[model samples]
Target: MPVPWPSGSICEAGVEQGIASKSRLVDVVLDESIGRSTPDVEHERAVAIFDLIEENRFCPVGDEGGGPYRLRLSLAESRLVFQVSREDGAAVVTHILSLTPFRRIVKDYFLICESYYQAIRSATPSQIEAIDMGRRGLHNEGSQTLMDRLAGKVEVDFDTARRLFTLICVLHWRG
Candidate 1:
């Protein structure tokens, strides 16, 4: 199931629009409505990528002032980012932020996700299972072992792995 957002944590009117006619087009607006997110095109695509991992029992990602964040997916030519942290016995939904827009500064976000997926797809079932387990428990020893095993095999840095691991902790460690 999707994580339940905290009450009064939704920022509906705080959504900002990019300056008109800039070199980059960050046109999407994110707002809260009825306890769910109401994001524009760019944001919605990122959310969909986030949902992919969430549905698969992985940490749901979010964005937060460019701090250590999580990557939901790089699917369909887009990259979805989110802020992940733990608080109050539950995974805090801090902010759903984006990187340089997918099609704006870099248009190959989803392609990167696809590439990662394809590369991992060639692993054995046991390896795949291990990765799934690693994704779910990035903060634990077992997950660390799993990730370490797949480190050079996959295209992820320790920093990325660490962030993704923290994200899993915050996502699953909840009230």
Candidate 2:
């Protein structure tokens, strides 16, 4: 005879069975309070959201909630706010990160990105590649900084942090 399982048991069993625990952003909303951004910035935002949703690992530290979270990103009063929620629309955690720590890296990343874009249009192939390398290095540094800042609040892989960092830069542009 089969044993009867309690409510929510199946879900718990799935976790124990090594079924991947889903932890990701199902939806992202950028607050309109920051005002409109340039088309190029808008494109970067779209791409980052698309790439993040495609593959990411996001688990809120010290929270027992299941994944597929919804995120609302905004900047207010020199702070970056991460409004997180569950798939069912329940409030999860709201993390506010100061912008001071990210200012230098974000500014440098923007500068290198501009150089890389301009190089692609007029510079020689080798020159463009060299600029692109600097751009990538800056991007990595920004991503690592983001990961460090979010250390006790959320856990995300390097690529996830990179994409999130891009979005943060977009917010910073008009913030």
Best by lDDT: 2
Residues 54-154, candidate 2, lDDT per residue (tens digit)? Answer: 76667676567576788888878878889999878899999999989888988898888788889888999999999988888988988899989988788
Give me the displacement of residue 172 in model 2, in angstroms.
2.9
Candidate 2 is scored at a TM of: 0.83
Q: Model 1, residue 63: displacement in angstroms?
A: 24
* Ten-residue region with minimum lDDT total, candidate 1: 19-28
lDDT by residue (39-146, candidate 1, tens digit) is: 343444445344433332122222222212232222122223332333222333433323222122122323333444665859777766665554444234423543
lDDT of 1 at 76: 24
- How does candidate 1 fare on TM-score? 0.21
